[model samples]
Target: MRNEIALTLQKALRELYNIDWQIDTSIIQRTKKEFEGDFTLVVFPFVKQARQSPDMVAQSLGDYFQQNLHCRFNIVKGFLNLTFPCQVWINFLKNNYTNTSFGYFATGNSDVTLIEFSSPNTNKPLHLGHIRNNLLGDSVSRILAACGKKVIKVNLVNDRGIHICKSMLAWQKFGNGETPESTQMKGDHLVGKYYVEFDKHYKAEVAQLEAGGMDKTVAEKQAPLMLEAQEMLRKWENNDPEIRQLWNQMNEWVYQGFAQTYQQLGIAFDKVYYESQTYLLGKQLVEEGLQKGAFYRRDDQSVWADLREEGLDEKLLLRSDGTSVYMTQDLGTAQLRYDEFHPKEMIYVVGNEQNYHFDVLKLVIGKKLKKEYGPRIHHLSYGMVELPFGKMKSREGTVVDADDLMEEMIIEAQNKTSELGKTDFEDGKASQLFEMIGLGALKYFILKVDPKKNMLFDPEESIDFNGNTAPFIQYTHARIKSLLRKAADHQINYNHQSFNEIDLQKAELDLVKMLYEFPQIVKTAGEMKSPALIANYAFDLAKEFNRFYQETPIFKETNEQLRDLRLHISQFTALVIKNAMTLLGIHVPEKM
Candidate 1:
């Protein structure tokens, strides 16, 4: 519709003023709430050329648009406000009410987008921080796909690192041959417990050494546990049989735990890359960098990339012992993805702390390796997720485990649902509804905040059924569903052409406009790469529907056509709410 306005202005300007005013469509904006128009156009730009006052110019342009487009107009200073006739809006509702894929689009060309997220380390279970990454990545992927992009979601597990060895070494010394089956602990959680134990004992050793008058820094390095962990890392790298077996065993346990969590979150990876498989390719890329003089090696034979020109500290690509760092595996994994997918863009949904790391990566890949895909690498750096109490530390076992958090959300959802006396479903159905509401609340709260801003996750605030929460929107949807069911029970079929000519109230018009904006909302959200836009849009639309519900009568109306029009609008609003929530990886229940 905005395009129609812009293109109409293009023809009007050319014919009226002999001015090829190349249709600056961006200037055409929604009119202010105080105004009487649907859209406003600035007329000051044509004033001098037309040899008229700003008011006269606006009046003339308004007349030209009203004549050409059949929309009524009012002029405010140099702004031309145009409102289309009721038929235009009613026709819009009639044409689109039944189309479920109303907002989906077909693009000019197919573009492949590869998104990498949830790069969990084997040393710990996924925490609240990982939840944000997973939600952001999954939601963005959904949004992009809706916007007509071919998206492949992937995960890179940091399966082999010294941090991992810390857990391995701790399990060897203090685990007493513990297994997940015997202990009834999820594999990942079990390994994470040992990781915390390693830190506790490692800190104790450092403190004990410092008690002997050794310097803190020196004691930290020379602690017996630290030394042993480093040795275990080396042995694992060298593929010692016992070390490899232990590494594989523990990682398998973690994988099982991770799978369960991913299922709970409804997240799946199109492909999973492990550092153990891709580090050699990273080593190959480093060698290529060295050959091209993109990096330098010290006398200790460790590879480094000098980025002082860019005001960044020098980055180590390889250690003195020829071991690879995170960058090494990342380089290899990125290249491997490019080779396989040839994506137009490769996005890494990592935390903001790795901003510089990705910057350096792009610099090396583009400036040094000079690879074509270097320019394709993108880092979707997002802020951390902190709780009301403060930040969490994975090493200290202070981070909120994703599994436990979801469980807590489900329990809270049950309590909240029961309080509302909405527990009338069969036992199994009631349980399922609790999980849906619980997870929906969690996902909506996290995704509602802009991805670039750190968010405080308050479980209590998220599970509420009022004010910008998922349950509110979900309940609104369920309300509509119940209304439609009741309409059926009364033997009132709403499908008919009579409602198309039915006069619409102001609230109904507002809902019609909101429904029409769905496509544009989706397109804009995709362009901005923000799901918060969609989340909030869904909330606002739900609120509008509720307002319309309260102000307008449906079944009780004396006019059959008017009541059917209201029901049609209500049904369409519910569909939009469900679609929008689905894009955020949330489910809207039929009952709440």
Candidate 2:
């Protein structure tokens, strides 16, 4: 409808002033609620082109729309407000109200988009921060796929690093042959326990060295525990048989634990890449850089990329002992991904702390090494997820465990739902409901915030069945489902009914208009790479439907046509809510 109006205005300009104008759809926007129209056109840009005052241009355009398109318009200053007739909205609803996949684009686009997220280190289990990364990456992948882009979700495990060595050393020294089966703990958590133990003992060693008059920095480097961990890392890199076995065993434990948590959160990856496997690729890149004069060898025989000319400091690619750094593995991983998928875009969903790291990655790959696909690298850098008290540290064991948090969310959901007297669920159904509400609350709370901003997650607040939380939206869906069931019980057949003759109430029209915006919202969210857009759009649509439900009668209406139209509207709204939440990697329960 907005497109038709824009085209009509363009024709008006050509007819009246003999001026050919290109109409941009962006100029036409939904009119603000305070305004009296459905759509608003900013005529200021056209004012100069038409050689008239802003108000005159708006009035002329409004008159043209009112005449040609049968749209009623009210000119407010320089804005042309156009309101379409009821039949226009009816036709739109008749066409799209029954579409099960209303807002989703058909798939099969060849533009591959590879998203790398949930880059967990084997030294610790997934934490609150990993939750945000996984949810963001997963949701964005779903959104892009909905927008007709072929998306490949990938995970890169930091399995070979100093951090992993710390955990391995701690386990070897203190584990005393204890295993996940022996201790009955999750594998990642068990390994994380040892990682913290290593930190505790390492701190003591550092303190002892400092007491002997060594500087704090020197004491830290000279700590026996630190030296042992470094040696373990070297041994592992050298493929020492015992170290290799230990490394593989511990990484497998972490992977198993990670799989359980990912299942709980409903996250899956199309491909999993490990640093141990990809780091060699990074070494090859460094060697190539050396041959191309893009990298220099330091006196200590370490390979370095001098990016100071590109506004970055020299980055260490290989250590003096010929060990690969994180950047080295990342370079290899990037090339491996591009060569495998040929993705048009490669997004790294990492924290904002690594902003400079990704910057260096792009610069080194694009400018220094001059790779053609280097410019496709995008760092979806997001802010940290801090607790109310402060930030978390993995080595210090201060991070919120992902498994523990998920269990808490489920328990909270159970308590809240029980309090609401919704305990009539059948056998095993209540547990399923709890999982849905719990996971829904977590995903919505995290995804509703812009990805670029840091968020403080309050579990109790997110589980509430009010405000912008997912429970509220889920309950709204449940309510609509109940209504549909009630209609079925009453033998109301709304399937083939004609809605053109019925006049839509204000609330009903508002909801239909909101529904009309879903495709656009999905498109905007995809382009911006932000799930917050879809999250808030679902909220608004639900809120509007609730208002419509309260003011407009569905089952109570005496006119059969009016009742049928209301029921159709409710059904369509429910489909949209379900679809939108699905894109956010959240499930909405039919009964919540």
Candidate 3:
């Protein structure tokens, strides 16, 4: 409707006033509630260009709209409010309510987009922050796919270097050959435990040295555990048999544990890259940088990039020992992804702490190294996920582990469902219901907030059957489904009835108005790269449906035509709720 209006207005403006201003659909907005139209267009912009007063411009556009379209319009001040007839909305529902592929526009020729997220280290388990990263990446991928982009979800596992060596050394000394099986723990958790042990013992060693009257900085460097971890990293880098074997075994265990968590969280990656395999590519890039003079070698033989002209200080790509830093590996990985996918865009779903790093990366790779794809690297930088007490620290083992948090979500779902007196489901399907509700709550709570904001996740608050949480939307969907089933059982068929035959109530028309906004909502959400738009859209739709359901009667209505309209709208609402939730990687149950 906005497109048709925009085109008509553009033609009318050129023909009437000889103006060539480009008008778009964005100018045609929803009419304010106090007005008496479905949509409004502020004509003040054209008042100056068209050489007319505000009232004159509104009147002229209103007349043109009435002639070119089926909408009726009225001008108040400078606002041209247009209201479409009943047949317009009736056609909208008839054409789309039954179309399962209504809003999704992805095709074979869509632009290729690669999103990298859920990059985890082998030394630790995924924490709450990781959950947010995974959810955002997955949701954005889904939204992009809906917008007709060929999306590829990718993961990079930080599986090597000093961090992993610390865990490996700790397990070697203190694990006493204990395995995930022997300890009855998840492999990632088992490995993470030893990582915490490494920190504890390393700290103790440092403190002992400090007590001997040594400076704290010197004590830290002289710590035996630190020295061992560093030596182990060097041996692993050199492909020593013993170090490599231990590295491979511990990494395998971590990978297995990661798989389980990803499955539970409904996350999947199209491709997975490991730092261990890609570090050599980083070294090659460093050598190339030196020859191209994009980077310089210091007296100590370390490779650095001078980026001061770009308003950033010098960056270290490689250490004096010729070892790669995070920037070096990232440079190679970015190039590697381009070589493999040739994606139109590469998005790194990382925290905001890396904002400067990505900035330097773009300048160094795009300008200095002159990689064409460097300018396409987007850092979807998000703020930290803060806890009520403070920030979580992995070394202190205070971070909320993903597995443990998921388990807690399920328990919360179960309790909330039971409290709401919604536990009448079959015993066989109860667990499935709980899992769906549990994960749905978790995903929605995190995804509903704008990805750039720092959000405090309160598990207890998310599972409430009331409010904007997933459970609320899920319940609304379930309620509408129940209404549809009842209509089905009673053999009340609305399939052959044309909704244009009825005098629709204001509430009924309002529901249809909300439903018509879904496709546009989806388009806008994709363009803005925010799932919060879709999340809020679904919540508002559910709230409106509840309002409409309360004020209107379906089977209880004596008028057959009105009853059919109610049932048709109910079915449509349920379908849309399910569709929107699915885009957020959430599932809505048929029964609450």
Full-model lDDT, candidate 1: 0.88
Measured on C-alpha atoms, candidate 2 has an lDDT of 0.89
Q: How much lDDT does each candidate structure score?
A: 0.88, 0.89, 0.88
- Could you tell me the lDDT of residue 426 within candidate 2? 88
lDDT of 1 by residue, 1-592 (tens): 8889999988887777777787665788878767888888988888778788889877777888888899999988888899998778878877888888888777557899999999899998998899999999999999988999999999989899888999999999999999999999999999998999999999999999999999999999999999998899788877899999999999999999999999999999999988888887899999998998999999999999998897888999999989788788778888899999999999899999999999999988887788998889989989988777778877655678799889988998999888877758976898888899889888998899999999876644544556898989999999999999999999999877665466677788888888888888898888778899999999999999999889887878998888888888988898899889989999998877
Instruction: Looking at model 2, report the run of 10 residues with the lowest lDDT sum.
Output: 457-466
**Candidate 2 residue runs with Cα over 4 Å from true position:** 13-23, 458-463
> Worst 10-residue stretch by lDDT in candidate 1?
457-466
Listed in order, each prediction's TM-score against the native is: 0.95, 0.96, 0.97
Per-prediction tally of clashes: 0, 0, 1
Which residue pairs collide, candidate 2? none
Off by over 4 Å in 3: 458-463
Judging by lDDT against the true structure, name the best candidate: 2
lDDT of 3: 0.88
